[model samples]
Target: MPLYQNREFTTLMTLKNSRLRIFLASCILLLGACASNDELDSQANAAEQQIYSEAQKYLRSKNYDMAIKALQQLESRYPFGKYAEQAQLEIIYAHYGAYEPEAAIEAANRFIRLHPQHPSIDYAFYMKGLAAYSGNSNIFSRFLPTSESSRDTKHIEEAFTEFAQLLARFPESEYGADARARMVHLRNLLARHEIDVANYYFRRGAYLAAVNRGRYVIENYQGSTAMADALAVMAHGYLLLDMPELAQTSIDTLKVNYPDHPSLSDSGEFDVAQVDEADQSWINKVSLGLFDPPQPPQFNYEP
Candidate 1:
């Protein structure tokens, strides 16, 4: 009884030990597999970072097209990597630098929609406005004395609205100051454009239309440099339209606001045409400097 029982117990203990060894080996193999996968992931991350760095170099060198390609590759290859979101942001910058304004605007809008809470979202907004602003610039106006503001007020108004949104939403953004400055210039441009339209009406003998344009300048652009000219236009236009009291009121206001204006006569009456004619001499006419040029039918307002 004692011999059989001892042999059976020894066999059972040996089998249990054999099973434990197999279990430990399986655990070790599983851990090794996990470690290999982790290492591969790390290597992949480093490669992604290197690609992102190369893209940054392209951006620094102002090779926007190359940068865009590299960034696109990095994003596609490592969509969930550490640099994926950053690559997206840099793509927008690259589009902007490449003078692809529509693309830049589209990218910026995509970023804003996808990453609304991103810390650098204000930059996207700023870029959007800047792209719109540059897109509206006329090359001819850069050299000509034409007013940019008066040319195409539509794009200018859209850009101003974008900037306004940026300023309103991110008052403390790095771009806020610049946006504000642009907004001021836009306001003046719009005002001057309106006044130019008023002058056109005056020259065409549309007195009431001219007066309405001047009133638009006064109401919509209160602090513009064109206010003095607007008052002159209103006074002259009212007088032409047989509105004596309104003309007198505009004349009085113009005198109070701009006593030394060139459009005013010695008696403080609105007399722009007289002043214009007086300044136009033979030499001045030939030289084209005798007086300010008349407002063209299609004038631009340069900011």
Candidate 2:
């Protein structure tokens, strides 16, 4: 079911009759040429096929270390031989199967970069993206500090970007179906990450921070419910900072973007619900639209 194998199977099954005959003739010619070649060269070519077979057997047994070693040996022994491409693909599997996602990503990326024009480039890109994406712990953990299990999302984004490239550059590739699915998941994760950071700054009462985060969500996330919340939060943060012009801009967003959003009565914007009644009365004086829009109270910080 992997993109590489699918391509091989299709190549074998769907060859036109003329093409199949041509392929058979080519194989006969190669065999005749090999018979006439130096005996040592023929033996070495047969040994190369055996090495490939042994590597595939190890892969089938899930003996990833042995498989990796076998493939690496194959590369060292016959760098430009017929098995090099297959060796590259198996190396990715060997690393991935051994829970070495970062290593798998690097290997997959190298294959794609080195063989950009190869027919299997789509599979290489897709596998690279999968390697990086699989390294991430999850989408929700963005609010927390980086941890041992955390992978830099920069890697994940690169994977997604590669997968998208695979989709675009190889429109007829077998990689497209699953790569498209992964692309959707990655896009949603990026959007969710934006919302999580926005909510973090919003809850900390850092209006400027909240506004920047909120704007990121809106500009990036587009038509989701999260976009509506982001717009509302931007407005609320502006209001709390006593920026009426910016707050007015958010007012239209609140009304037109999400008319059905419930209005919580604690609209004074800055943690008014958590403040004492006397403190509430003071904040109401500066809160825009909620106040009469007259000259705000002038007060000095008293010692």
Highest lDDT scorer: 1
Q: Can you write out model 1's per-residue Cα lDDT over 1-303, one digit (the tens) per residue? A: 699999999999999999999999999999999999999988997898789889978987989899999989998999887777777777888887777778878988988998899888887887777677656654454346644644777767877888899999999987788778777777777777777677677678888998999899899888877777778778878888888899899989988988877777778767857533321210111123311111101112222
How does candidate 1 fare on TM-score?
0.73
* Model 2 per-residue lDDT tens digits across residues 66-112: 99999999999999888887788768878876667788878877887
**Weakest ten-residue segment in model 2 by summed lDDT:** 284-293
Residue runs of model 2 more than 4 Å from their true location after superposition: 1-46, 135-152, 235-303
Clashing pairs in 1: 147-300, 147-301, 147-302, 148-300, 148-301, 148-302, 149-301, 149-302, 150-301, 151-300
CA-lDDT, candidates in order: 0.75, 0.65
RMSD of 2: 23.2
**Deviation of model 1 at 248, angstroms:** 3.4
Q: How does each model score on TM-score? A: 0.73, 0.58
